[model samples]
Target: MKSVQVFAPATVANVVCGYDILGFAVDAPGDEVTMRLTSTPGIRISKITGDDGRLPLDPAKNTVSASVQHYLNALGQPSLGIDIELHKKMPIGSGLGSSSASTVAGLFAINTLLDNPLTTMDLVPFAMKGEELACGHGHADNVAPALLGGFVLIRSYEPLDIIKLPFPEDMCVAIVYPEVDVPTRDARQIIRSKVQLKDAVTQWGNVAGLVSGLFMKDYALIGRSMVDVLVEPARSILIPDFYQLRELALAQGGIGFGISGSGPSVFALTKDPETAKRITNTLQQHLQKIGIRSLSFVSSVNQQGPVVIG
Candidate 1:
């Protein structure tokens, strides 16, 4: 059996305006997994390091372990012994798509270690299993961007369909991950089941406008279109001074911002890298005043997603 490596970049989901439906990749901060095949029957994983002793090592319970299992099952090959070491480059549950990155990297790593039986296009559905296990809901918005790279819109989930959108060149995304974790399940629960008609109309219009803004490469319109009434208002309760921070960022040249992948982590998009830098600094300063210190990144869109390693 050949040993191989896989690398998956970190991702930011729900880029302010697009919730549960949009995401993009970032460079420098991602997880790396090393996979080696074993002659022993039955797939097993060892969580060697990273994650600050927070991740589960159980093969049956962890996302990376489960992803390898899916690959083995699909091949119908004899149970293979697989050992993986996940380098947790990013903090878990920081809304930077830590789990999705792990899940995607695991899938790609194992697929390569097994001699590449499945095509990349065919593997996204398998990668999503870990997401389902972690989030209790099968949402590919985050995983897709992590797996496929660039900006992604999950147009539909019935057939696990996804559409990739171009990342405008001038725009940059800055993210702030507060040192807290908000379970996706709990965050989902906080949202109001039914929204006011006015809010609903406004949201949908914004969604359409955002999509159009992407096509037109109009940063201002895209910034204007990022408004959420149903999820943000309800979920913001989990964060400290969410509304104030959001307003301050906007006033300081942040095109727009919303809860990033549930809560705690917040992100803003800007017209240029300067604006992105400003937004990043402003968010950090404001968040500190509220006693909520955060780690921030000023990054542009990533064109590459998860890829096989040598």
Candidate 2:
């Protein structure tokens, strides 16, 4: 194939309990990237859209292009030429894994055009370079699910261990992106370097319970275990009316509600699509009442990750 276009779904990282170890893909509000092979011997960014001119044009600086470069270098094919075009459909620094979607889309597209030179698992580390550039942390909580789809658990980081867990097919995710900018790096900085052993134990148990609940399709257990006593306590203060929103979601039949990744974008899970829509409306309307303009979507989990379009 001379060219390929891929759509990578937006992802929710942490999910209240898992932090940097878990995430899942959503259907709408993703990134689109197109890659075309060229005879010249280097990657280039020919066009970009929807980034408000804030993103870089140079291949070396852009997340999608930088990931493409890393993928090529890892395959010992840096001399090959490729042109990239990025369309950022989601807001940046909204805790929605915007950069990860773009990075995964570019890497997935290029790999497809190259006739599947790398396996899906092999793409994580290469795509992480983009995360490192964008957020200064080579974390896979966002990118892994965006690349592999469904619910992803990062079992280990030393050897890049990941597990794709089964998700309830009918469950829906409700997300509201308030018009606020909270960079992942800044949100991460507010976290303390140390935690009490008691809190650590509680967090571990909650994470374990969350995993089991997800696998067993136990919605009640999942909701109970979605508590984030560690990170949320510190980060929730950064988001306006965070606790009130969580309370509203839970009252409106949401299974659980919490900050999506870092902050400024919150998500809630519901057992069915109707409940998800109601929660979305409730959240968006509440935000509007508070004079905060927002964007909201209700979608089932996206199991297909990234797909080739053209």
Return the top candidate by TM-score. 2
Which regions of candidate 1 are displaced past 4 Å? Answer: 308-310
As for candidate 1, its clashing pairs are none
The TM-score of candidate 1 is: 0.93
Question: Which tens-of-lDDT digit does each residue in 1-310 have in candidate 2?
Answer: 3888899999999999898999999998799999999998899899989989999998889999888888888889987888888999998888999999999999999899989988988999988899999999999999999999989999999988999998788879999888877888899999999999999899989999999999999999999999988999988888878998999999999999999999789999999889988988998889899999898888899998999977
lDDT of 1 by residue, 1-310 (tens): 6676678888877766577788878764678887777777765665556777888888888888887687778788637777777878877887778888888888888767656688665777877888888878778877888888888898778866788887587677777787766888888887777778987788878888888888888878888888876777788888878888788788878877877788688888877678777877887887788787788877777787887666
Off by over 4 Å in 2: none
lDDT for model 2 comes to 0.91
The lDDT of each candidate is 0.78, 0.91
Clashes of 2: 0
Indicate the TM-score of model 2: 0.98
Alpha carbon deviation, residue 7, candidate 2 (Å): 0.4
